[model samples]
Target: MKLKQLILFCILIHIVSFTNALLRRCFQCRSRGELGSCKDPFRFNATEVEDEHGLATTPCASGWCGKVIEGGGTYSADDFDMAIQRMCVQRGPDDNEDRCAYTVYNSRKVFMCFCQGDLCNAGSSFTASKSMFVILTSLLYLYSRWNQY
Candidate 1:
């Protein structure tokens, strides 16, 4: 009947809207000029506040989940410092995408990455880049060897 069809359509719409309302999540933590899981070579240990994989996450209802790394100071000396922050960022329109941006101010260097989807702001992106670098380097080495013959 028409009534049944209308009700079914309304139910479907409600389900889709509900799914869309579900917010994305990302690791939420911070560390400043000190050593911790939130710092370089980030390795978060298992804790009750973290997920099963030991990642501390928070809901990102607006904008995108973001990870920020800031470091500065003389690398050859003991004054080197670093900071890291992971959280939901609500900024301009461009903050809604999956991209990494780097900026430098004075002696400080900052690297910030924004990403959509649940838990997409994790450190996997760094690992992926490293893997790609290895693959590309190997390919270039092989190409040079082949052309040498």
Candidate 2:
């Protein structure tokens, strides 16, 4: 009976460790800016009217930018937009012509839309924060289970 229990405990520890490693890898992938670059010069399709003088204002597009892996991956820009929307209210004027720009950083990978921009941005920070949360949660769960043993 003791041997059986030991085996079970060992198995549980292995499982937890494996899961933790996997989660950490995923977190690193998202946080390290390894995936891509920011799409630069993200322009608005239409000119906007100024609030007071009716002058043409510099058009801007409200969108999240992040890095994506090369040779295709499961990540989607729409999913990133949804996640961002969940976190914060949309910025800028509500214009249909406004666009969100995404840049894939890998030299080998080609993104269908959005021009290349600097990788430094709010989205990268958000990604790192989220990944840290996931890693911490996984660790907490493992710690709890270990204590129960």
Candidate 3:
């Protein structure tokens, strides 16, 4: 019946939407200037880099994008090095999440910030909204599928 077909179609659409959101991964990179969009030759395998900085790849499943800053001071000495890390965050800017905690060690204040879009944490300002991109892409995909049938 048409009712059964409609239910199945609705389920299929939901599955596609959920899958797209889950698969939306952020690029793992450190930047001195500003982080670019996670396009190009990079694909999401979620690989961690082995280094003293202890940076890791992150997925934006929970909520927003995050940036971790360590050693926000002078870098004149040979041992002085600044590290910037980007990851998928679970909470927003005002949320009291575990990952958003700030701690200081050895006169270094470890700071964190959150943004609500893909690659939006590249800098202080968000270039584009990830949700917009997702909605647009999804619409196009659904439109193409409709045309096919």
Model 3: per-residue lDDT, tens digit, 49-80?
33324334456775477666675455545322
Writing each residue's lDDT as its tens digit, candidate 1 over 37-120 gives 566555553244454432477777773777887765456343135677777876524534467788653366788877765555
Q: Superpose all Cα atoms of candidate 2 onto the true structure and report the RMSD in Å to 1 decimal.
A: 17.9
Which model scores highest in lDDT? 1
**Model 3 Cα displacement at 108 (Å)?**
4.6
Residue runs of model 2 more than 4 Å from their true location after superposition: 1-126
Clashes of 2: 6
lDDT of 3: 0.53
Cα lDDT computed for each candidate against the true fold: 0.60, 0.32, 0.53
In model 3, the worst 10-residue window by lDDT is 36-45
Candidate 1: regions farther than 4 A off:
1-19, 32-34, 40-48, 51-55, 72-80, 92-96, 104-109, 125-149
Per-model TM-score on C-alpha atoms:
0.52, 0.21, 0.41
Q: Stretches of candidate 3 above 4 Å error?
A: 1-24, 30-58, 74-79, 95-108, 124-126, 130-149
| lDDT per residue as tens, model 2, 34-72 | 212222222111122223231122212333222232333
